[model samples]
Target: MRLDPPPTTPESEHRRRIGAVQEAMKREGFKLLIAYADCWRTANVRYFTDFRPVDGVHTIAQAVIALPAESDPTLFTGDGCLDYAASETAFDVAELEHLPLYLRRHLNADGRVALAGEEQIPVGLHRTIAEAIAPAPLVASNLLAKIKAVKSPWELEQLRHAAVLTDLGMEAVQQAVSTAGQVTERQLARAADVAMINAGADTPAYLSMVQAGPRSAFSLALPTNRVLERGDLVLTDIGARYGNYVADGGRGFVYGPPSGQAREIIDAAADAVEAGLAAARPGISAADLNGAIQAVLIERGYAEFSGEARGRGTGHGTGMDPEEELPWIGPTDHTVIEQGSVFTLKATINHPQVGGLRTERIVHLGATGLELLDTFPMRNFW
Candidate 1:
């Protein structure tokens, strides 16, 4: 059965987010905060204005939210997005080309300004904006990201809806792979995409990934035409996006009975994910959480395939973006896990003989403990 869409973030919540960012800017001596967003990285602008750009080949959708410490925020986009932005967001709308004029009105030469999403801002645009606010000393800041790290009640509901959609997609993949015979990886991936869209997702959070046999050894490989065979290990990573929030999850499967090595690797990854979840209470450092998961892998004699050895973290925060920066669960990251944060706990292993196996789930750190957002069977042998 299809799930209904979650409650949309009200205009008040958007205002509150803007206020929070303004407060942070005031503390940091930033007189104006300019947040840039493109089609890909939209959290910063969307957080303030709730307007997500619709990108296209001719229209490289981009948006900017200019928030002055003392004044209301303005949302700027191309003429193509003007109507949509006006309808979706409760902010003053302007043409993107007029950004310099708007900035000149709100910014003073001696005041300090900060730019969010600095890394993704185009060089030409950045130079133009810098010149527009000349002598204002626009500097890079992570204020928006830090503030958005913790999910609000409204955002959490969106994420939970997304998680349910993602679970349905993964379940579709599991069912497709379990069919009698000759199912190709591409077919399985299609099954998942169709299931999620039919179930009311804005879109699959990312390309549905289905890798079987030797192809599964590549962590981020796209689906191919390789047909599944008996004794071959299969891995599928899929997610669903709803209400601008997203859920990322994955599962492993064996076409036939699993080999002893395959079983061991999958079990180790599952155990590591469980350990990570168990240790995900508030007040614990992300490093501690990663250590808990890594410890399980090491004890299972799969240290070489652990995230540390592979240079990938055990897990990451998830929300508007599929992968948020804060609470990066890794060996050296020391960010403390806070209540109300949501994350994707994942453990992946690759073996030359058996292939790659990954177990992932979306979770939220509630007041009590980590709450599993996605609920699907972890072990599958078809």
Candidate 2:
């Protein structure tokens, strides 16, 4: 069987994006905006130019896209390989040194400029750019986050495709857990990794979190060499990336039979997730959504496991980067739900007696309702 390569964002879409940002700059009184990209945080650059910098563990590769108010955007990078990788993108490619010269050619030093994805831009590089383009105010802004939060139809298609690949990965993980009898956490993680790549994912969205037994309580714990045992709950939170878009989710499975408390928690999480989806429509506040999910969990006698009591919010935004843009679904976030927003809703709980359990789903807020993107079964207490 053959898998299609991840679809590229169309040239027209890129132009549309540039035009929108240019309009935004005109409104904000800025002449140029520089969007930075590094190994992990590539959404700002990729949002504008569809070029993601290749990165490795501890490797410091970087790229930047310069979007002027009324000129063609340009791509600046460290070396030839980055240039080669960006050949098909709509921007003109150049070495990082050329940035100062390009800014000189494109805008006057007195022109107002801004930096997008400032956190992703290294301090030294920013100092150099500021020094080279002296007298131009370089303000930092999250303009891309504002613009990219609303999904273009092209982005939605890419996200939908990514979700399919994620479903494949999750399916493989569940199968390995059910049939492998006894396996190491790494074995289950590898099963998911191989399945997603074979199904056309650029990479696993994050290193698959395969925590067995009590270790499942720790969300940030990596897969260890310990073997999964029967009667233990195995928590698997994994997904795949497609064309830089992510499909992030997870589910819990029991290697053997689950205890009554385990079943109750799983059922409560499922109900809360459904309540979240029900509340996730245009015009609702992020707080409203959070409150709705919290209500469900509280109603189910898990009030201590609801909201901040459980250690994390109900969910966060998802897109080109897994944590792309945000209006966190928590008690305090007042960001309104808007049409075309893509995000995830998660129901999670951890107790000293019952261990940890979670279920996640990706969704896009359409004109009518939430378009559930993740099709993998929510195998509660599997």
Candidate 3:
């Protein structure tokens, strides 16, 4: 069955978003905020004007959205006529060819301006905009990232729909792997990908991680043509995207019944994720939560298996991107977990004898407490 997302963010909510950013700019003394977006980081611009850049092949052309503290936001796209005709955008959109003229017209010579998506902006474009308003000085900031991390009601609903579709995809993969005596990893991945696409997702939320037996040791390994044995352990990491929001998490499975080591590692990872979930309420520091998760594994006598020893951290925020926006739940990050924040907590272990086992769950810090967004059962197999 296909699951659909709730109605997209309304025009009123878009106005509220613009107002919130303007308030933040006022406090920070920024006269204007210029945001950039490409196919990869489209959320930065989508937050202001519900417009996604056309997914062109072989090119990552950018679109710009300029939001002055006191004026209506204007969207500038290279394919101006196409986007203008296709997008039911709330604000005005003009050809990006006129960017230099627009910048010259609106920018104050000495006013402080901030740029969002600074890292994603191409070097040539940045230099052009930088040189256009030289004396004003373009300041690089993560203002939009911080603003977008907190989930609005509409965004939360979108995320929940995405997670439901992701669960459907995960279930399909689990069935594909468990029912087959010798299925290739690529075949299983294709099952999950096609399931999500059929369930109303724009695309697969992330690159599928489908590994069997020894290959599971690589946490982020891509799907391969390796055939799975009847008793092999299978690891599947998949998600789905709906209304620009992403769902992220995965589970492990055994082609048949799980072996002793496989069961033990999977149970230990579950214990760690459960511990993290209990401590995921608002006001906990990301570091403290990371510590809590690790403490469970250490208590279970897996002290030698430091998951973050690979240096990628246990988990991260999931929103516009599949990972890493805010409240980076790692060993050293001190970002305070806040209400309305949504993220994933993953626990993983790579053992010489047990291969790799991982369990992940998504959570939203509701007003009263934590809400589990994903409903998939954490079983060892279908």
Give the candidate number with the greatest TM-score. Answer: 1
* Positional deviation of residue 32's Cα in model 2 after best superposition, in angstroms: 0.9
Residue 265 C-alpha lDDT in model 1: 74
> Which prediction has more favorable lDDT, 1 or 3?
1
Q: Mark the regions of model 1 whose C-alpha exceeds 4 Å error after superposition.
A: 57-59, 308-311
TM-score of each: 0.95, 0.92, 0.92
Q: Compared with the true structure, what per-residue lDDT tens digits does model 2 show for residues 1-382?
A: 3358976678888888899999999999999999888877788778766666776522237878888898888888776445564676766788877788887777786798889877777788899788867888898986767788888888898889888888898788878877886789889899999999888888898888888888876655789988977666677888889876888887877777888877777777778888898888888988889888877777787667544334357887888888765757787878787688898888876665666667888999888888999887665444
Each candidate's number of clashing pairs is 0, 0, 0
What do the candidate models score in CA lDDT, each in turn? 0.84, 0.79, 0.79
| Residue 150 displacement in candidate 2 (angstroms) | 1.4
lDDT of 1: 0.84
lDDT of 2: 0.79
The most accurate candidate by lDDT is: 1
TM-score of model 2 relative to the true fold? 0.92
Candidate 3 local lDDT, 152-240, one digit each (tens): 88888888888888888888887786577668989988998898888888888778788888887766789899998765667778988
